[model samples]
Target chain A: SQKIEQNSEALNIQEGKTATLTCNYTNYSPAYLQWYRQDPGRGPVFLLLIRENEKEKRKERLKVTFDTTLKQSLFHITASQPADSATYLCAAMNNAGNMLTFGGGTRLMVKP
Target chain B: NAGVTQTPKFRILKIGQSMTLQCAQDMNHNYMYWYRQDPGMGLKLIYYSVGAGITDKGEVPNGYNVSRSTTEDFPLRLELAAPSQTSVYFCASSYSTGAKTQYFGPGTRLLVL
Candidate 1:
């Protein structure tokens, strides 16, 4: 079975700094990888998505890099703020797109 | 748009009891999915429907059932609930385009004893 791993340890950074989260998968060559933001007591909200063919994608202050070579992806939030604190999840979808398998997720905390 | 909406935000059920978690979306999307999230674990897809009558099982569909009778509604049913069924459930919908983004509901919290 395919396995996805994200840093289980929370990432803590000072406000206005860049916060980076890592997602690595094993034995899975996904068609597309996506990132989501989740808060306590709520479902995840889609943030950004990058295909295996694409190297990187950015939206506003958020950026995502897909390095299929290493089976890893990096999610970066620039100028992070307290409000940006949340759990970040990475999901990998295969060619059939039947379902998205999600990683455990990394919690990001921006301190002021 | 109302995005996705799930009813009965919280519920408590006894062993062998059954209940349905209602999910609806006003986006007229063609793809709907049900997922469960347990502590320390990310979301796990339970079931998904491509359209109104086409349903498929996901990784954790063993204890759950789903029906998509309309484009806007996808409900998840739990028959004879068990302790392992206790988890937060979310319903999401997306456009027909493969790999399109999904809109998710607030999720329903279930507790079984």
Candidate 2:
């Protein structure tokens, strides 16, 4: 079975600083990977998606890096704000391209 | 667009009881999915539909049932609910598979006592 792992501990960072989150997977070579932000009691919202051939993708203040060789993806938030505090989830497309397998999200707290 | 909507924001059911979680999307997506999220765990796919009348089991579908009778609706049915079925359910839909962004619903929280 494919396994996705993210940092289980909460990441605390000061506002205006950069917050980086890690996601690692094994047993599958996904064609694409995605990142989502989830607030409490709400569903996850899409953030960014990076394909296997793309090493990095940027949108506003968010950036995602995919390393197929390492089977890892890094999510970064630049100039973080208090409102950016939320759980970050990482997911990868299944080999069949029909579904996604998500990692146990990493909670990020941007303190002002 | 309404995006995705789920009914019964929260519900508590007794063991062995049955209930259905409703999900609807106005985006006219071809793919819809049902997932359960437990505390400190990642979302587990229960069932998914490629289109109307085409459904398939996901990673976890032992105690759940789903039907996609229309393009806009995909309901999850829990028969003989157990404590293990207690979790937050989320419905999501995408335009198509392979790199399409998924829009999620507010979610339905279920508790089995």
Candidate 3:
């Protein structure tokens, strides 16, 4: 069966630190991978997307790396702040890149 | 643009009852999708439409129905709501390209008793 996994445990870090999250998948070769940020009691918002041919993508202080050979992706938030605290989700295309399958998400808390 | 919007932010339904969860988007996107999220689980696709009048079943489509009559409106119908149907429902829209980013609505919290 196909599976996607994110860090199950919550991550805590002080402000101005770098926070890293991981996503791993099996049995699916996606054309692209996406990251999303979701706050409590709210819907997810798109963050970044990395294509299979791209090794890294960055926007401001956020960065994402996709390693197709290892079936893994890493999300990073540099100089994190309290406002950046939220659950981050990783999603990948399935069924030939038409549908999306998401991981459970990793909760991140940045303390002031 | 309001992006994607879903009506009835919350609903409580009795088992066997039927109701429709409404979703609309103003982005003029050609692709729309419906998903359900259970506690501590990832979002599960219920159904999706590439364009008006064209729909397809997704990973978990049982007990739910959806119709896309217009480009801006896609409503999910729950026939005989079951306890298993209790979950947070989200509506999303994206461009015609399958790899494009999706924008999601706030979602509807449904409780079946």
Candidate 4:
């Protein structure tokens, strides 16, 4: 079975600082990895995605790095704000394009 | 685009009862999926459909059933609901592209006693 693990249960950071979340997977090599932001009582919204061949992808203040060899993906948010406080999820799809498997997710709390 | 929509934002059911969670999308996507998220746990895939009339079981599909009769609607049915079945259910859909970025509904919270 495939297993995905996030760095921690929660991370607290001050405003204007950088927040980094880790995702590690085992048992499979995924073609693409994605990140999502989820707030309370709402569905997750897509954030950034990085392919296996791509080293890094950036979107505004959000960035994602994929290391296929290490089976790890790092999600970073620069100049974090209180509004960025939400649960961050990591997901991956295999080469066969099968169902996407999700990690437990790391809750990010940005302090003002 | 209305994106994805789910019916009955919250529901409470007794043991042995049955109900259907309705899900629809106006995006006319080809891929639809059903997932359940328990507290402090990741979302577990229940069922998925590639297109109309093509469905497959996912990681957790023991007590759930789904049908994709149209490109816009995918309904998940729960039979003989149990305490273990109580969780927040989410429906998502995506286009047939390589990215496969799924759009999720607000979600339907189910409680079984």
RMSD of each: 1.1, 0.9, 1.1, 0.9
Candidate 2 C-alpha lDDT tens digits along B1-113:
88999999999999999999999999989999999999978899999999999999999999899999999999999999999999999999998846867899999999999
lDDT of 3 by residue, B46-83 (tens): 99999999999999999999999999999999999999
Task: Using lDDT, give the best candidate's number.
Answer: 2
**For model 1, how does the per-residue alpha-carbon lDDT over B1-113 read when each residue is reduced to its tens digit?**
78999999999999999999999999989999999999978988899999999999998899888888899999999999999999999999889886767789999999999
Question: Which candidate's DockQ is highest?
Answer: 2
Clashing pairs in 1: none
lDDT of 1 by residue, A41-73 (tens): 998999999988999999999999999899999
Between candidates 1 and 2, the lDDT winner: 2
Residue A103, model 2, lDDT = 94
Please give me the DockQ of candidate 2 compared with the native complex.
0.90
- Residue A66 Cα positional deviation in candidate 1, in Å, after optimal superposition: 0.9
Error of 2 at B96 (Å): 1.9
Q: Model 4, B1-113: lDDT tens per residue?
A: 88999999999999999999999999989999999999877899999999999999999999899998999999999999999999999999998789798899999999999
Worst 10 residues of 3 chain A by lDDT: A93-102
Task: Give a tens-digit lDDT track for model 3, residues A8-43.
Answer: 899999999999999999997888899999887788
Error of model 3, residue A112, in angstroms? 1.6
Each prediction's whole-model lDDT (CA): 0.92, 0.94, 0.93, 0.93
How accurate is chain B of model 3, given as a TM-score from 0 to 1?
0.98
Docking class of 2: high
Q: Comparing only chain A of model 4 with the true chain A, what is the TM-score?
A: 0.96
Q: Give per-candidate clash totals.
A: 0, 0, 0, 0
